[model samples]
Target: MARAPVLAAGGIVLRRQATPLIAVVRLRKRNEWVLPKGKLDDGETPRAAAEREVLEETGHEVSVHEFLGTLVYDSGGRCKVVHYWRMEAGDEPAYELMYDIKAVDWLPLEDALDRLSREHERAFLENVGPIALKAAALDGAARRKAAKPATRRPRRTVAPPPSVSEPDTVPAQFDAQVTQEEPRSTTEAAEPAISAPAAAESQIPPSFASDIEPVVIDAVPMRPSHASRRNLIQRVRDWLRRAA
Candidate 1:
């Protein structure tokens, strides 16, 4: 008898704070509150397969930020190990219309803890909670780092305010400015408006109208010739002579 190959996958149930902590779907159909997961497909790494399965099973978009932990279990006498990861779900599920997901709902973290059925589920909740919190703290520190403005050298002393007497010279400057502006404005006024030109007229000749419009021709009736009438009378006369 051949030994069965060990099957492996990964899952992460998410919980957000609310009246009830919102954890990911507990699939009643699958009988597990598993983060969407499946066996590693041929040529696919365990971690990549885990992420792909989660996205397929749950319509939610998720990014795998870090590896969480692993769970060992059994299915049909085969040993299975599931390696988990912490991923953030996008606000909207990218694959909701896909058929694999029967349904999804968010439950409170506490409620999820109380309701989760698997032993691995308990372990994951415990292990991942602290890791996630730590990850969150690290994220906070990074954000703080980003928010801190870079140290800038003291700005060079600003030049003293322009003299108040400059306003009296405005008339002289305005005359020169208007003389420069008038010709440019007049030239700009001569530019064309930016609408599409009307369509060109069709180039077809008037003689081609007969092809365009359907034309009906009357049929001429057939007429018998004078020779045929004479031949008929001669045949009748020959028949009378033969009878006599």
Candidate 2:
């Protein structure tokens, strides 16, 4: 025959003062300080019952995070499994205690670890201790930051104070741009803005003749041929013989 397991829920509830403390409650009948855990009511979820139980037993409002596994042990003939969470307690529970809880006290987590009656509960604390410690440290840091006053940052300096000459030059340039007076019109009109080569070209005189020969190499007539010289000599000899 299989044994039916009893389901229960509770928390590792932490509250911070100078240092963070875990909430461990003393049981009236058992005369032991243990993490608060109880069997679920009809139609109650483990998480919901855990929250309700902590409120009822310890009188502290808690916001729970991380379902921190379970512990199962045989109680007499029946097996029992208890689920746990890492819960952060608020200012007030706003509810009255109504069960086996005699007193709930916040003690340093290390002390509470040692104080827990069950070895199983202490093992659970050991597993989740680092996470709880980190949360507490972060919470403490945030509170410190919030409480600290904000400081005003110093204004940035830019350009240094202007020199006397710099101020004088600025007005001179401004006056020259905005209301600059031109000198009285002179006999020589303002010179045209032209390149040096272009000005030289404009100064050159225009040529009238189109086919003029250059002074360096003049044109000349063709020289006499050898045939013309020989013909002239023969004509002279014939004329002299006839006259004699």
The lDDT leader among the candidates is 2
- lDDT per residue for candidate 1 within 1-244, as digits (tens), equals 7556575665564533323233355565676655557778889898888777777777776667678777776767877787777766655667752464556666555555666667766767766766765674575579789999999899899899888675654587888888888765554665433111111113444465344433333433435666676554555454334333
Clashes of 2: 0
lDDT of 2: 0.76
Show the colliding residue pairs in model 2: none
List TM-scores for all candidates, in order.
Answer: 0.53, 0.60
Q: How close is candidate 2 to the true structure, as a TM-score?
A: 0.60
Task: Judging by TM-score against the true structure, name the best candidate.
Answer: 2
By summed lDDT, the worst window of 10 consecutive residues in model 2 runs over 208-217
Candidate lDDT values, in order: 0.61, 0.76
